[model samples]
Target: MRQDHASCNISVGSADLDLDGYGNIMAQSQQIFDCGEPLALDIDEKILLHGTSWKNANSIVCEGFDNRMCQNAFYGAGVYFACAACKSHQYTCNQHKKCCSCKCQRTVIIARVALGDSYVATETRKKERRPPVRSGSSGTYDSIVVKPGLIKGHHKPNQVHQEYVIFDREQAYPAFVVEYTL
Candidate 1:
């Protein structure tokens, strides 16, 4: 059924609308407004909302399911830098600020030298003369040349010195070097 009216009269109380946390208006009443109708409301209303002022926000913290939703920011020097989680290390230059690059090491023998293993030598032995003199006589000694004794000694021995290079993961070039004596 259709009713013909010259003008439509309606009254909306203060309870008709609800304001959300951000002060956005939410309609509560089911009053329908027809096209080409002069509408009327009853009360003058203003609602308080939240997070409307920029000065109220303190810290920048964002979280989301995927990488597209969350934003990590470095707020400093009046600069609000916002970036995705994947690119945060590059944006903040944190990748270059490393404490130690090398996590593993490998030892390699660079050089080895060999010296004389053993040597033989000779010595002079002093022999005392026959002591037949009485209590007042001093004993005379004679120097005799002796054959080379079986003296055993070693010279500058061969040594195995190793030079080690440290690397991180599969890095092609070494980060540092360490020397070891074996």
Candidate 2:
């Protein structure tokens, strides 16, 4: 089993993006996903990749285009580059060079779940089911008004559970959020 950490994912199936922009699908290469909503990656998922770029800033934040860094660096020595080229570089999930090479910020990873094996990714986080449970459900089955029958886990616990990253969410994108911080 391959162990990894990751951040938010962008889907490949997103409809609005120009399909002709990125080069032809390289053999078995996957497609790009769409992110209908916005999300953030925990520090563990996207490591800080520092470099210098001359492009204008994407937001009021900074002009750091390729210079921007992932909040969470992969488990390795940062990203590997074929030079200064942006597309030529790749992120390593493992500290070694053999682990899966995560290209593009929204790269998908493989994961095994309680149901079965599948793919999950950062890009699809927004597409998944995020049902909101009422506080009463947490109250549990109280045989007696004074006693609670079952213990219920928080639907989405506070940020503490967001600390470590899971690396594999499902495999539509392999990477999922584990435990993380802003």
Candidate 3:
């Protein structure tokens, strides 16, 4: 198991983002390990980032990712993750005005995502509820991978950042909570 700490600066675009704090999500390791075993003995997992509101981040850390909470299902109705921290940063929210006068900090969850058998999404599938069925097989793809520049849609430009989506909630384990300020 790899242990991550938020002691270094993260470069997003030209800006260097200094983390306010980084801590483990707590109590998710065994669950993540158990969930990946049936998918593959090797466990094809990737450490990805997911950005959301501070309130939602707390909920996720406790209850895990709920695909129904996904507001934008551009790639599919699932929890979305980004390979680049900058891409995930775009979704972070500063919703602290009503609660306190302190500078609102943005939150991003660094997760272990099990992308067992990924299908590259060549086109926009906004209405797709899950990964499409394999062309010549009865089994459906385990996850979706949308590479940069493949999609053209009204809501999104030719996607400039890579994204991964998993329909099963257990497929992702929130590993770390990183807080930062712009």
Candidate 4:
């Protein structure tokens, strides 16, 4: 629950958290108006994990995810989560060298992600900036899924492990911050 990293001079801004929470609430509320009635709970919502440096983890919990800050866009310019802990653990590198003497403790966030409709991705979509627009529809796919399987004629899969990505920040809620040492 404690999302702040005081030693790194990073504190969760109440306004930031409140504003993001409010926006998500409003978005969900609008669905009722758009559909003219309340809808059933989304089946795609999932509990997923995301790993990052301790500093970045604080920012994500406080300000919410900003895909623009994504360093790797292998799947797309979106926030990445994984069903497998080891997949997310690949990203828990300490980028803030000066902030920590030893990078023993790693951080991973447990998030509630609304993965609504997912599009399975091909290696060709590696540079995609966002989810592909749905065929013959104005709305885009809600998320992207990259699985571990070789494309025909290819030697290996573009990804070794599965990854899930959501382009919209509101689709994810940082529910827990877990710190552990390997």
lDDT of each: 0.17, 0.20, 0.67, 0.64
Q: RMSD to the native, candidate 4?
A: 14.3
Model 2 sits at a Cα RMSD from the real structure of 19.4
- lDDT by residue for model 4 (95-155), tens: 5422243547888887776676677776645577889976644456777876665533334
Please rank every candidate by lDDT, starting with the best: 3, 4, 2, 1
lDDT of 2 by residue, 1-182 (tens): 11212111212121111122244332122211112322222211121111211121122123212212323332211111111112222232223222334341322212111111112111212222221221322311101000111213323322111111122222112121221111
Worst 10 residues of 1 by lDDT: 111-120
Q: What overall lDDT, based on C-alpha atoms, would model 3 receive against the true structure?
A: 0.67
Better of 2 and 3 by lDDT: 3
Query: Could you give the C-alpha RMSD of every candidate to the true structure, in order shown?
Result: 47.0, 19.4, 11.5, 14.3
| Candidate closer to the true structure by TM-score (higher is better), 1 or 3 | 3
* Cα distance off (Å), candidate 3, residue 85: 0.9
TM-score of 4: 0.68
Error of 3 at 45 (Å): 0.6
Q: Going through the candidates in order, what is the number of backbone clashes in each?
A: 0, 36, 0, 0
Model 3 weakest 10-residue run by lDDT: 1-10
Model 3, 98: alpha-carbon shift in Å? Answer: 18
Candidate 1 accuracy as TM-score? 0.13
Pick by TM-score: which candidate is best? 3
**What would you estimate as the lDDT of candidate 2?**
0.20
